[model samples]
Target chain A: MKVANEQTTRDRIIETARQLFLTRGFAGTGIAAILKEAGVRSGSLYYFFKSKDELLVAVLDQYKGLLRPILIDPVEAATNDPIGRVFALLESYRGFLLETGCRMGCPIGNLALEISDTHDEARDRVRENFDAWCACVEGWLVDAGDRLPNDLDRAELARFVLTVMEGAQMQAKANKKIKAYEASITQLRHYFEMLESRAK
Target chain B: MKVANEQTTRDRIIETARQLFLTRGFAGTGIAAILKEAGVRSGSLYYFFKSKDELLVAVLDQYKGLLRPILIDPVEAATNDPIGRVFALLESYRGFLLETGCRMGCPIGNLALEISDTHDEARDRVRENFDAWCACVEGWLVDAGDRLPNDLDRAELARFVLTVMEGAQMQAKANKKIKAYEASITQLRHYFEMLESRAK
Candidate 1:
């Protein structure tokens, strides 16, 4: 019971920090801001996180944990057809973008832009998350098997898909248009169909 | 003579602010930091720009002004063939990326991530820059002439192309791999080819 209470406080701190980080960015957000927003008070925030950086790292981890399933689960479950799975994954992302009304950029991509050189640990985490994502994409391509080109490179394809998704989301948010995201998915789907036809 | 001196000082301040903002981001960088890095006195920094936010807006303007030619000039010159112009513009960006070692994210994209919602004027500049860029792309598509489908929506296609380019750049920078960017361009070229074929 006591552990649960402590965990709840920790979770609240993470939630508040994540929101602030997404809305204001890491540098703009401070420990005091997180503490005040979370209503945890300074001592409690320090008790859970040693510093603002540590809190930001914790918030990043929390985001990663939340996003992995949102991003990967659809692709993972659509194990039946690799190409279909890839499309489904993208479609799911499109749905999310539409629902959110295109507010925030990809949290992972945002961190990548914000912390590439200044923070080694953060950079590594961002890279690891991206690699894991690419691995899932690579797995889907492998499942596509005979349908994909005999020489189709899975890693390269995954990277391309990720790039489109990340970039499309940013564009959609910037322009406040769902069509931007849809356009990427449409082009990707067209490309997939072309690849499948070439296999025949 | 007074105006010239003032312009030089202002230009110096904006340039220094641009480099710092790109490297450290908005919140991580302060006016004091800008003055120190630019070797300009604090009084001079403030004499030209009213506040940190004002300086950030100027930095954003500088970013747009700098990127305009680097991104748009090639496309503008290759006017004879819209499709060709598109590829040439992208190729030029690749050269820039290679020259710089892909150290910084797209400046406008970076600022969009940092302050899109938080700063309205800054966001408007980002929007205008992107809109202008999209217009440049649309002009290329229009020039692609009958090679593109009569019914093919050029605006949508332009947005899609922008998404892929921006996303590819971000992914490439995040992983420090040129392959990511290369893959997107390759696919994009393929996409243009498909449009050409379908139009015919």
Candidate 2:
């Protein structure tokens, strides 16, 4: 019972910090805010996390763990078509923007831009999250087989998808308009169509 | 003499704040630090700018002033071919990453993700800077003429390019490696090739 209760407390702290970091930003968010929001004592938070930075890392770890469930699986279930899944994934982001009024951006993209220059451990974890995302896209591209040019460097193309998505989201959030996001995704779709037509 | 000197002091302060904001981030950087770095007193700094947010808007406006000479003109000087100019601009960023070991990502991108949720004025400024950048790229695409599909949406394509560049830079900066950035650029190039071939 004690172990179960302890694990729940830690997870609650990590989850609260994660949402706050995404919404409030890493630097803008304070340890006190997390404790207040989570309804946990500072003693419990400090016992689980050595400092605010450690809590951020814990939040990042949770993101890593949640990617497939939060990001990939829904899109995967929606479409088994490999290339289709790519766009489906983007469409989901579109819905996310709709719900948030284009705020909160991609958690990793936001965090990466915010702290990649200064934080070492957090930066590596952020990169790993990004690389793992690219890997998922790469897997879809691999499944794409001859639909894409045999010579196509799927790995790099995967990176491009990520680039467009993050860029689109950032611009959309900044402008508080969905048009920028849609415009970028439309262009990416056209690029894919061009590639697919060429392969034929 | 007093007027000219004051203008110099204000410019110096904006420049210092811009660099520090890029390196240490907006939230992490303090007024005292900006004062120290710019070698100006609190009264002097506040006399010119009301608050840190106000100072950031000034820095962003300065980026607007510098965009042509700093980003577009150099690449234009390198290549007469319109399409080539696009890639040249990306190459310049690659060089920037090489120099900084991918430490500081795109200034607007970092700011957009960092403050888009919280700061209304700053977010607008960031988006305007982004739109200005996309317009420059759109102008180049328009110049490319029959090389790309006439059916192509030049404006959205420009947005896509911005997305890719910002996204690629963010990833490269996060990982402190140029490969991710290079990979993304390569994919964009290939996408352009496919479009050109289709036009042919």
Number of the top lDDT candidate: 2
Residue-by-residue lDDT tens digits, candidate 1, A44-128:
8888778877876787677667655777775666667777777777788777667767776577887777776677677767777
Global lDDT of each model? Answer: 0.77, 0.90
DockQ top scorer:
2
Query: What proportion of the true contacts does each candidate reproduce?
Result: 0.55, 0.95
**At residue A145, what lDDT does model 2 achieve?**
96
**Candidate 1 lDDT by residue in tens digits, B1-200:** 36535659888889888888877788778778888888899989888888888887887777667655666775666666668787777787677678777766477777777777677787778888787878888887887779988987888788878888888888767767677889988877766776677778
lDDT, residue A76, model 1? 64
- Docking tier of model 1: it is medium
Compose the digit string of candidate 2's lDDT tens values, residues B1-200: 37535668888999999999888889989999999998999998889888888998999899989899999998998899999999999888888889888986688887888878888888888988998999999999999999999999999899889999998999898888998898888889988998998899
Structural similarity to truth (TM-score) of each candidate: 0.87, 0.97
